[model samples]
Target chain A: MSGSPGAGRSRIVTWAVVGLCLGLAGALAWAMLDLPAPSTRLPGQVAAQLERSGVEHPVTAVLLNFRGYDTLLEIAVLLLALLGMLAAGVAPRASAPLGASSMLAALARALAPLMVLVAGYLLWAGAFRPGGAFQAGAVLAAAGVLLRLAGFLPAWTRPGAALRMALAAGFALFLAIAALGLTEGALLRYPEPSAGALILAIESGLTFSLGLILAGLFLAGPELPRREDGGGTP
Target chain B: MSLGLFYALLGGGLFALGLAGLILRPHLLAKIIGFNVMGSGAFLVLVGLGSRDGVADPVPQAMVLTGIVVAVAATALALALARRLLELSGDMVLPGERLRPGEDDDADA
Candidate 1:
């Protein structure tokens, strides 16, 4: 198939890349095989201090309490990514009007409220089981996406002051709490008595802000017009 | 080998595959997908290694959860950039990269 010089060179490059990947895989396998046992076990440590960490679920405890600094920075990173997207300077195209799909609209109407309820459950369940702000926020975002698809909500071009505030609320609250913790001798060190309540409050704010941010990631982008619709310039 | 080791090895394979895809693919969207594949492989490695001793470790699991949310955010930003490029240049491939003859036609299509 390499009939031309360019094709031959491309073939060679492909082979080299494949060879490099194989070597990487081999090296990784070798490293794993020769790995020494870790000196400290984190899971045990988490379990030992679970009582003081606030949440019953170990993962939740680690995320919202033990390593909360990471979560705080993560929320900041999410907001930054959204900000970058907004600053990319792509003009918002008009959203396509929904066709007569009453079934889809009805389905979205039925599911939206249910999804909101599920998100709430997930938020409440995070204290004891394998559910948390992230899952809850994701569900809420999915609902928003569905609503947009069903024509109940329109694509966002520019967010208003309230919307912007809503988007930043979670990160701001997290930072504030972390700052307040400085008075407690350490960053994010919640008072033991109110740790659960504090974590819950944080999760609730995160769920609200994260939901908007995640949905905005999709809805903020301009929708491409269909070619057959005569929307493109010749 | 233990289950954890097996998963770790699988993750290594996935990482290698994703690396190849990221390097070899010409389309920006494909490159983004390749990047996601690489991220997933790394997440698998992290959790697998942490639990190789048979105990479920919450630290790596929590980190992976955090990584997932960040990955979604990154993917969204990347997609927005790609769409902007498509709007401005009418193609998804970056400039200066030579497209195979048939690939150019595909891009126009």
Candidate 2:
């Protein structure tokens, strides 16, 4: 291993280190010295217009009305992620080996419910406040991860029709709303006075589907066999 | 572009770097690390942009809050995949070959 030893190896190592440092310096310099202007006038401009028109929950309005199409796509992206996980032959982690360290078990007991509560709060806050369905779903999934890690939850739960319903709710509900647009010429539009409520409703559905889909993806495959095996019993 | 512009560009660059690292690194776990870097970078950019008038953009910050969750979900999924790969392969880590199940025990002994 020491045949060519000091010279060749040291020279290469020295250059590699130098190159990395130089790259870092250059990147940092650029980021620090030059920054861009905000092209973020769209939201503000829209909000102002909504405000002028006395629109309630302008942020919600923006999300549900002007940007409903994007929201629809975002939800679709999440579905695709779950579907991709399936196609890739990945599955949710087997339920935690259960009864691991007492510390983990105790932590799960205390944190799981608390995390769920926080997720609910975050979701509720999304309307006329801050935060939303995505954050809530993440929190819910995190809680699930904790329980799974602590072995409190089985690697796979028995599949039920409820799971299927929850999984499809977001997409299905959004479709119904968009259908309204078709019938009323709104084209996925939310009318005033109901925009906030609609956004909240859509978000709730999104939270449920998103949480399940993510947890499913993170759960890893064998735990929930492919459709051919009939899900849950594992 | 101002700092807001700087924020987006820098964040985008970091994300791109992270994405590149995730793809280029052969190790399964390294991809996760790259993702974390990219996620953090993007988050920083969003937050940076939010601080427009020396106060954060409530909207971007909130959206980023949502984004953190999405990122976490993706990470969880990737991790589960890595763990399964290890279990199926009987290798604690085929990624970077960095950590093996009993390597630590051997070192301690």
lDDT of 1 by residue, B1-109 (tens): 7788888888888899999988887889878999999998999898899889898899999999999999999999999999888889888888986457676465458
Candidate 2 C-alpha lDDT tens digits along A113-219: 89989988988886656567777888888887777666555443343588767777888898787777675567786665565667677888888887777777655
Output the number of the lDDT-best candidate: 1
DockQ of each model against the real complex?
A: 0.76, 0.22
Interface RMSD of each: 1.3, 5.7
Which 10-residue span in candidate 2 chain A carries the lowest summed lDDT? A225-234
The lDDT of each candidate is 0.87, 0.64
Cα lDDT of model 2 by residue, B5-92, tens digit = 5675567667666766565444676769888988987787777766644644546654555566557657765776667676688554
**Across residues A1-234, which tens digit of lDDT does each residue of candidate 1 receive?**
359998899889989999999999999999998999998988889999999988899999999999998999999999999998988857755445443266767788789999999999999999999999999999999999888776667566677799999999999998888788898999899988999999999999999999999999987855444324321221
